[model samples]
Target chain A: MTRLLPVLTVLLAIVALWYAAVAPMNIRQALDMAERGGAVVVPEGSRVRSETSVWTLMAQNTGEIARGYALDRPRLPTPVQVGAELWKTTGEMALRGRAFSTRSLIYHGWITLQSTLFGFALGTAIGILGAVGIVYSRTMEMSVMPWAIISQTVPIVALAPMIIVLSSQLGIEERAVPKAIISAYLCFFPVLVGMVKGLRSPSREQLDLLRTYNAGGFASFLKLRLPASVPYLFTSLKIGVAAALVGTIVGELPTGAISGLGARILIGDQFGTPLAIWAALFAAAILAGALVTLIGWLQGLAMRRMGVRA
Target chain B: MDIEDVVVASDLSLTFKTADGPVHALKDVNLTINKGDFVSFIGPSGCGKTTFLRCVAALEMPTGGTLTVNGMSPDAARKARAYGYVFQAAGLYPWRTIAGNIRLPLEIMGYSKAEMGERVDRVLELVELSGFGGKFPWQLSGGMQQRASIARALAFDADILLMDEPFGALDEIVRDRLNEELLSLWDRTGKTIGFVTHSIPEAVYLSTKIVVMSPRPGRITDVIESPLPKERPLDIRDSREFIEVAHRVRDGLRAGHGDEL
Candidate 1:
């Protein structure tokens, strides 16, 4: 409870500040809309306030402030508005027998999830293979590691479209493959670096002891290098999974895929529905959180079984 | 091809070519360790005691001369699993249990599961750590961990044991106790043992022969055979024979230092 209190307090403060900013941010548009509807309009820049108090100024512009918070297409959606949209898209939409419907977040969330998982799996395999190559061979370490680092510096947004287009030309029609490749590209570096470090983590004494046993290269790798890399692999895997999700979303954007959460966000932006964008953003955050938590659970189980403390 | 000479090094030299300069870690090192002999190499920090031990285990190759173990090349002896090596620190794999650590060499040697289990149990009992098989290396005390390391080395029942300062990290009381236990273990096993240490009393107490070494191109100054009886107690350190042997080792070390100036 004590640990949670500080986090909850900070979250509440952010929500309160968000609510307070809604009025000032959208007030000008609200007043202009009122004027266009032939309502009484206070031109605030031309008029001087009788009292400099904030409450008095707010009282004078109550109707306009209310309209600002309740705008159908706000530039910045209030937390409550975003919350309502989420509830409507997920809970209300599901209750109304359209759980898998186009309007439902659950439908779009599932679409994004498939690509994210595929990308994560591909990234892990690439990372492990890259790490093993680097550890086992001096040539691979010298040649491949620098290129892998250079690959990460190129922005995913710029590269995603190129990858998608090139892949399509190569007769790869499935949209998820390119996205998975991009996700794998994002994730592999951390796993590679971590595994390399872990593989080399054993002491000289330990290596010498293995030498005395006359253990072969493959036997030593399986017995010593691989088990030693587990904790490090999991740490990289957590980072990789999150990066994979970001890669999938970025991959979705340039392709203009209309099925995933990234597409939902792009659609909401085009229609100027801030609430729609915010809901999709929240859904992506939730999905990433769940994926990372699953990795953490796996890490706990594996590490515990290996007698490594959390 | 002498059957009694378990290890024979003739004019063995190892030079490491670093970016700074060539470090002559061991130079023209020649020694013979016979079967069933407890030999301890006592020296300063850079005296190549560990280097010589590593060469015997085939972990390092001498740049010149010949070094053989069990009447064969060190590499061939290593391939035959002729010796078990215990390092300075108890280098137990943290992820493995005490029994798992002990079973490591056996597993690599392709021993059957039943044999591996039986040997792990027997060695654990031999080391007086019978119930510690389930515990991780980190869970045990430093002395206990070193004992576990010894048990690991003993698991395969090899003809020779190479140990490099196995108890150097422990407290004095723990060191003394482990030394006594090691003497008894050596007596029981009859394995030819090469131990390296910095302590004079430990050298005098544990070995049938003590090799005094000096730094600056790492070579043996003198090899002193112990005049004391094989059956030694902890209180043997107070005896005249033990002190006389300890003084010879001290004299050999001092003589080597005087030659440097």
Candidate 2:
């Protein structure tokens, strides 16, 4: 609880700042609405005379500020509005009808999560294989490593559209595949780097000891290299999973898929509903947090089973 | 006692080709180590004592000349599982418990699980680390970690044990105690041991034969067979014979340094 104090304090500060900004950001729009509503006909000179500072304007127009905070289409959603939308979409929608239906945030969250997991698995496999190649073959180390580094330079946002278009041309209609490939593209690099480092981590003495035992290449790799790489693999997995989720969401954007969190964000933007956008953002964050935590738990179990400190 | 040669090195030379130039690590090293002999190679840094041990373990190939172990080439002998090597550091896999580390070689050798367990238990008892089988390497003190490493080498019951400065990192008191324990362990096992160290007293106290070596194209300067008995106590380092052997080792080291100049 004590450890959480600073985090809670920072969160509270951010929320307060968010609430404070609502008035100033929306004050012009609020006054425009008030003028349009014919509540007051303000003379151009009187606007400068009435309020010298934003704080004073805010103090004088509490009703207008409250109106800004309660806007259906806010520039920045307030914490309470976001929380209510989150509840409405995920909790209330699910409780009212089919839990996995179009109205539910849970449905969109699951769609994103499914693609993320698939991409994560594919990326992990490819990364481990790439790492093995790099470790064992000098050619792979020289060639593949440079290419892998170059691959990351191409931004995923730029690549996602190309991947989606190409896949669609190939008659790949499943929207999840392109997203998963994008995720795998993002996920593989960290695992490759971490595994390479991990596989090489055994000391010279340890390798020599293995040689003295007449342990062959494959034997040493399985017994020594693979086991040594576990901690590193899990560390990379946590990062990869989060990256995979981002890739999946980015994949959703260009295609305008109407099923996942990305679609919700797109729809929210189209309809000017800050609530939906905020809800989707929070849902993605929760998904990433839960996935990372699961990986961490698995890492703890594996390290403990091996008798190393977790 | 009629003895059989367990290790034979004739005109053994190893030169490492570095970017600067060729660094001669070992040269013209001729030696015959007999079965059941406790031989210690005493030398200063870069004297190639560790290099010689590595050759015997087949970890390094001699650039010139011949070296054989157990009547076979070093590589062949390695394939035959003729030896176990302990390093300067304990080098225990941190991820494994003491017993698991000991069980490693046995597992690699495709021993049955029952056999692996039995060997692990027996070596743990031999090293007096019986109760530490479940503990990871970091949990143990420096001496205990080294002892566990020794147990790991001893686990597969190889006829030859190659230890390279296994106690070099320990405090003197712990070193003294471990040295005594090692002698008893040697006496019990009767394995042909090739030990490496820089300490004259440690060399004098432990070995049945002390091979003093010199650096700069590392070669044996003196081979002194101890007149001391096989059964040695901790206070045996204070003995007159032990002192005489120690003095000879020190003199050999000094002479080797003089030759380098």
Candidate 3:
């Protein structure tokens, strides 16, 4: 309860700030609508209203300021507006048996999640195998590690379209294939660096102790290096999973891909519905939080079972 | 190659090639450790005492001269699992329970499931850590952790034991108690043991044979065979014979420093 209070307080503060900023952000549109309804707003002309400071216009037209919260298409949606959109698209649609329809955020979120998970699994496998190779062989360490680092510097946004087109040219029909590849591209580096560091974490004494036992290389790795790398693996996994989600979303952004949450965002922007965009953004945030928290919980479970204290 | 000799170092030397220069860690060191002997290498820092013990364990290669263990080359004896080594720190794996840590070497050496369990139980009892095997190393005190480490080394039942400052980090009261326990353990096992330490009294109290050494091209200054009987108690340190041996060790250490001043 004590831990929860601080988080709740901070969230409330952010919402309050968001609500306060909504008045300034959407006031001009609200005033224009009010003027069209024959109400006398202080700024006579739309151009003058655009030039005027929003704060001054706000103070001059207190009655019309509340209208900003009620606009059909707000410039910046209020928290309550975003919340209602979320419920109408998710909970209300579920009540009408349309939760998995094209309009529902859940359907889009599920699509995004599939690509994220596929990429994450692929990236983690490649990363761990690469780390083992790098740790055991000098040639792999010298050759592959620099290339892995260089791979990350090329922007994923720029590469996503090229990957999509290249995969299509190779006769791959599945849209998810290119997205998952892009996600894996973003996911592999953190896991590789972390596992490399983790695989090398054993102290000199620990290694010497193994040497004294004359343990074989495979035995040493399985018994010592692998277990020592668990905490590090989890840390990297958290980062990798988050990066994978971003890569999946970014992959959806290019190519007018009309399925995932990223597509919903693009659709909302094109239709000029700020509420839908805000709701989709919030859904993505919630998904990322859930994935990272799930990894953290798994870490706790593995550590506890291994007799490691918290 | 006497059958009774467990480790024989003749004109054995090790020079570590550092970027600064070659460091002569040991110089023409000759020693013989017999079967069932408790030999302690006593010296100051940079005196190669721990290095000599490491050489016996085949953890370090001697650049010059020959060193043999169990009548074979040190490397071969190591492969044969001739010796169990204890480091300065306990170096227990935190993820494993005490029994699990003790079972590590046995598992690596391909002991059967039943034998591994049996040896773990036996060594835990030998170290008086029978009940604490289920506990994690971090949950135990420092002294208990070191005891668990010793139990881990003994679990494989190697004939030779090499310890490098195994109790150097403990408080004196804890050290004294562990010293007594270690003496009893050595008495029971009759394993050929090579211990390294800087404490003079610890050297005098525990070793059947004490090799006093000097620094700067590390070499043995004196080898004292204790006249005291095999069955020694902690109170034996207060005896006249123990003090006489300790005085001789201190004199040897000072004589090694004579050329420096």
Fraction of the real A/B interface contacts present in each candidate?
A: 0.95, 0.92, 0.92
Model 2, range A28-104, lDDT digits (tens) per residue?
A: 55655666676663332345724556566666666667667767677777889889999988888778877788888
Predicted structure 2, TM vs. truth: 0.95
lDDT of 3 at A162: 98
All candidates' lDDT scores? Answer: 0.90, 0.89, 0.94
TM-score on alpha carbons, each prediction: 0.95, 0.95, 0.98
Model 2 DockQ vs. reference: 0.83
Tens-place lDDT per residue, model 1, A194-214, is: 888988887777777888899
DockQ of each: 0.85, 0.83, 0.91
Question: What's the CA error at residue A68 for candidate 3, in Å?
Answer: 1.5
Clashing pairs in 3: none
Q: After superposing candidate 2, which stretches have Cα over 4 Å from the reference?
A: A41-63, B1-3
lDDT tens per residue, model 3, B1-261? 689999999999999999999999999999999999999999889999999999998999999999999999999999999999999999999999999999999999999999998999999999999899899998999999999999999998699999999999999999999998999999999888899998999988999999999988999999999888988889999999999999999999999889577
Write model 3 residue lDDT over A1-310, tens digit each, in one string: 8789999999999999998999999899999999999999998878899999999999999999999988989998888889999999888998999989999998999999999999999999999999999999999999999999999999999999999999999999899999999999999999999999999999999999999999999999999999999999999999999999999999999778999999988899999998899999999999999999999999999999889877
